[model samples]
Target chain A: MSAPLVIIAVAIAVAFVLALWSRAHKRMDLEQWAVAGRGFGALFVFLLLAGEIYTTFTFLGGSGWAYGTGGPAAYILAYGAVAYVLSYFLLPPIWRYAKARNLLSQPDFFTAQFDSRLLGALVAIVGVIALVPYLQSQMTGLGLIVQMASYGRLPEAWAIAIAMLVLALYVTLSGVHGTAWTAVLKDLAILAVVVAVGILLPARVGGLHAMFTSIAHLRPGFLQLGAKGMGVPWFISTVALTGLGFYMWPHAFGAVYTAKNERVFRRNATFLPLYQLILLFVFFAGFAAILIVPGLKNSNLALLAAVEHVFPAWAVGVIGGAGVLTAMVPGSLMLMTAGTLVAENLYRPLRPNAGAGEVQTVARVVVWLVAAVTFLFSIHSNAAIVALLLMGYNFVTQFFPSVFLCVWRRAWVTLPGAACGILVGVLLVAYFALTDHTIVAGLNSGFIALAANFVVTLLVSAATRSWDMRRTALRAADIPVHRAGEYDA
Target chain B: MSIRALALIPVLCIFVGVVFANRTYPIVLGMPFLFFYMVVCIVFTSLVMAIVYACDPANRKEE
Candidate 1:
């Protein structure tokens, strides 16, 4: 076999082995499938959250943004660190609440807290919409990696189809456990590749200092944010919007639910920033790429292009394997989250009498369904990875106000008020995104919409004085129940 | 102030103050000032969180 073929085969084999291994010593149930029975300790939760956060977007898209846009890409680094700080305070209470109530998903939190199945269904709908693009972008990145790694010998579409199939099968079988096991391998591969390429490429073209000097010479505003483009205001606003919105992703919230305890969740939050330091190396790789390989049409290919230029075929294969996992691990988790949202929150609530077996059956079916849809969508996708991420973030961030308020304990934000606020916030986000209009100077359009959401939520809550909802929320917060076994089918 | 509240001071500073260190002057360890500043904020965040965890009542209860 050729060099690319050898590399691709080795990487795929490792990923398959990891996936199959994750299913070992685990029972098949909704609790096991959805949230891993809420038994994950700090280290497992840390790796799982790391896997969920640093997707193909971080590997390909982070480098891609650094290569394509230059300074604005700094926002990528800023947001994760800020989100970690937020999570320190945000997650423990949530874990406490979730573990107490046996809440399996983000929508379950909303449903039980507000006593509104409609609210739960609404969250499910919005979450599915937000997550599909995220899922598709990973497919897009995987397609690019496979096609590029194979020296264009393999078609992008076929690569995506195979990845989608593999992702769906593992997710249907092992759920979060499978994603976590693959993550351990994926994270190791990514850290090694990112550090090696980050240092190697820069040294090849002189040194880190020399590479930046040359990039500064070629592209004057490349190393720092310029007054003319992506100014301080834009950077600050984007970081803030993204930071606040970070854990609002339903899949991320689901990961938080998997933590063994409040203390474990808190510790993971405290330590996650260390994991984020890996992106700096990724940025270095992108900075190196601009000088080493120029005139690439798709900026997303910057890392691959640089690797191909600098590394041997064998090393490139290793990085390619890592790259494929970066996409697949997160892609499978997304399929699981979106699938659970549809079956558990959307259908189960409506049916009201569905057995656990029936619910699990629906979830498995939906997993395949989601993968197929994302597969078809990504085949025709033209959006860049960074653009897809930001677009998804814009919509998902609208949930921040409602979720934060729900967790804060003192806030009496009513169910109807939350419903209205979410509708308005989502509409504003859609309108601004569709029009490509800058509603406020120096700020992300999403931030403006989020502010509007908070204001609307506060006003509606105060006006109606939702005393009954307040009582419901307070009661919901206090349910410190022991972990219950799986609901009988 | 309590340790929990104190921990947020640096986080507020990083988000509101240090983020504007956007200028490329005084590059430290091959990173721009803004980049260096962000890294500091991240490290600072970890430290503060460590402090909060140390002081947390939950830890005390376990002990």
Candidate 2:
């Protein structure tokens, strides 16, 4: 085996062992497996949330956008910081509700709050649909990284299959604990590699200053948002839409339930933006690639190609290992969350009498099942799944209005209203995504869909709301909405 | 101003300010003007949140 392949093999082995090590002496009950028994301290919660930020997408696509689309790439940085700000208020109520109710999955939040199992099932189906494509994307990204870093010594198919097996093994054995432990390794490795490449790659051509200067000379106005397609309006709307929708993903939403206390979120909100600055280095790597390795048809390969150009085989292996961990950490979390959603929300509602042990068994089985399906899609290169992945963010964003409403003192929207609203939002997203009109009238199609969803939800709630809801509303109004002492414990 | 309202400053700087800052000329700190502005806004977001966290009574340690 080549030196790079050997190093990658060792890294994957270490990550797998660490994932199993996290399961030492702990019971893998359904609660423990799904949300780490809601016992993670501030540090673990911080790492888990931060782990969501630097996925295979950020590792490659962030830089890819910088190479191909230029100024539009900065939206990645803008959305996360804004999302953190929103989370400071949004997540505390959610964590409190989930903690009180012992909720395990995102759909549980909808089910409990709205008193509708149908809504829960709807969300479960949507979450699983949105998540499978996401998982396949991670697998696809891992395949690309291993194939490139190994100099084609390792085929993408074998690489994906190996990763899927390891991910399934650890996720089934160790659950969310496995994801958290592996996240520790992933964050450190990606941080080191991003900083190293972000700095050294630029120095090869010139310094950061000289590199941007050269890019400006090569592609004038590349650093600014364009006047037509990706103009200022598109930039603003896309950033707002993504920022609002960041935490709505089922995995991200479910991750909040693992926090030990509400204050963990407040603290995370404070420092997470500082952590987001790491992407600046990622963009630096992409910009450096533009000047160093020009004329790459596949812009996603920009970062890996640049690394291969400048570094030795062993260095490429190290980066590839980091890349693989990036895929595995999130991929495991996604698979676990999807499984729990199916078993807990979808199957449990149907069986009703299923014991906790039975649910855990079903969840584990579903994890492997999802892993197998996404693996097949990744290898087959299914056109439909690829298209679904394109609108995955928009699909998840449809949940935001209902989530925001559900967390209110007494949710105003009735269950029918919430269900109908989400259905409309999702249908609009499907229409826009299928028609290939992601931007309509210079605004993100998702943003427009969300606005329409909000209007329809309100109108329907106003029509469908009954007398009991009004009574509840009146009682809720008597209590102050923002009680400073309520969450202090 | 309420601490929650104070949070809106970072939101505005990111969502609204990016429009006017979309220029490539006169690179600051080796970054294009737009990128430099975003980096500053990202740093500013943390600082603002830090202030919010410190001032909010709900975050105070209880006896």
Candidate 3:
């Protein structure tokens, strides 16, 4: 019933075969399954990153958000541009360690940076937990698209159930290569749909003038810069959460770190913003739909409504197919990252000498396990993945305070300082997010949490005064001096 | 120039163009000028990418 069983079957079948082929042929060992053997170059990395960015959130949720929030919807495009530029400054140092140490997760970087395995594990645990809601969000989105594609013939829960089964089977079989190949098709389809709609939607809206006049008449604030209903504080804080939180996604870090060279990454870091062409068009399409579907409640379906209004059934099918593939591609990548982090950082540490082949097998096994549980979670009627993602933002960001002040800034810094910083950061974020929040509206709770973290680090550092930043940070980065394994710190 | 001014130019350009189109014309191509500005943002983003890739020494390598 969901996605015209034929369409769902076709998509599921294609995703499954692709995953199996990659697992059988492309995956040679743990590195290949986890990081595609560190061989992604210009086109490959571009496509993979493309798949990463265009999620179900973009396909269905972008227009939906706009339709739902009106003026505030511009945040999608607004934050995206900001996120990439901000990450440019942040990603290089991360890449340096990932390359040298074969790091597979963000927690790995934290461990290597501070020379504290416990700190590394804390980040790893928080990241994995945070991803649970994100994964569920993707599942919910997949269900919505599948239902839309089915022409609303299937109920939402059933649609979600079917898509989950197919996604789970395909991802478990294929590994990262499976996701990359499918992403190429996924990205191509998204571009074609976005470009076609971008040119057509404005025409259907009775010219841009009428649309503007209407927005002014009915939803004046839709044109407002402040987006007062949500306010500047929420927007700025949400954008900060997205910008900083994006690079911290262990999946993205793992993928970018797997790039062939710093040049490719820097190119990607700067150039990937170029690919945001479709996102810009999407923001427009979301705005366009507002005039036509004034009574519509769901903002996520604005793109679909815009498509149905401007185009016909067959074209709509193609767009729906693109949405499903978007989920499959990135959802698979998340699984790969989650699996690798579990197997390599958490599992391998316990076993230490597990063979590459065994580690690879463990990663594959974990993928199936994680996918199954996430699918079950997705079937529920009212789970909050978006909020959970913000929660993840709070948790993952705890690393930043210690990262900036304690670990990289000085050598011989006491581990207690770093631990206290992370602890306070997490506690402040938790208190602000859940309890009688302290930080006033404009600033995000995460920012407040970070402030707490930074303050704690300074206090502890002053108390210790026993560490030298230069000596420790250099050693933490593992820059080879005279010997391969010898470290100065 | 201050960093603030350097950042303000492009942001201001976006606002000016968006305001001009919204006030002056009908939505062309089923979109308003602000919608079109988004396209401009996307294209401008690409141009920025091309420049960075071409100029950044870190991006180029010996074959």
Chain B TM-score, one value per candidate, order as shown:
0.81, 0.91, 0.52
How much of the true A–B contact set does each candidate keep? 0.48, 0.82, 0.33
Model 1 spans > 4 angstroms off: A24-53, A173-179, A227-229, A409-411, A437-440, A466-489, B56-58
Candidate that would win on DockQ: 2
Against the true two-chain complex, what DockQ does each candidate achieve? 0.56, 0.75, 0.29
Each prediction's RMSD over C-alphas, in Å, is 5.2, 6.4, 6.0
Clash pairs, candidate 2, are none
The CAPRI class of candidate 3 is: acceptable
Which stretches of model 3 miss by more than 4 angstroms? A1-4, A26-52, A151-153, A207-209, A225-229, A305-311, A353-365, A372-391, A404-414, A430-440, A461-489, B1-63
Can you write out model 3's per-residue Cα lDDT over A301-417, one digit (the tens) per residue? 677777767676667667777777877876777777777788777776667568998998888888778777887777754533344455667777666655544324654345667
Instruction: TM-score each candidate.
Output: 0.88, 0.88, 0.78
Q: Which docking band does candidate 2 fall into?
A: medium
Candidate 3 residue A410 Cα shift, in angstroms, is 4.4
lDDT by residue (tens digit), candidate 1, A1-489: 557667776777777776666567553333343345366565654544444446888888999888888777878877877887788788888888888998988888887777677888888888987888888888888887778766888887897887787678767666544545566678767776777888998888888777777777787766777543567777777788889888889988887887756776566567777767768888889888998898888898899999999888888888888888888777887888888899988888667678988988898898888889888888877767887887778778888888888889435588777888888888988898779754357677778888898899888877767675666667567445411321211
Candidate with best lDDT: 2
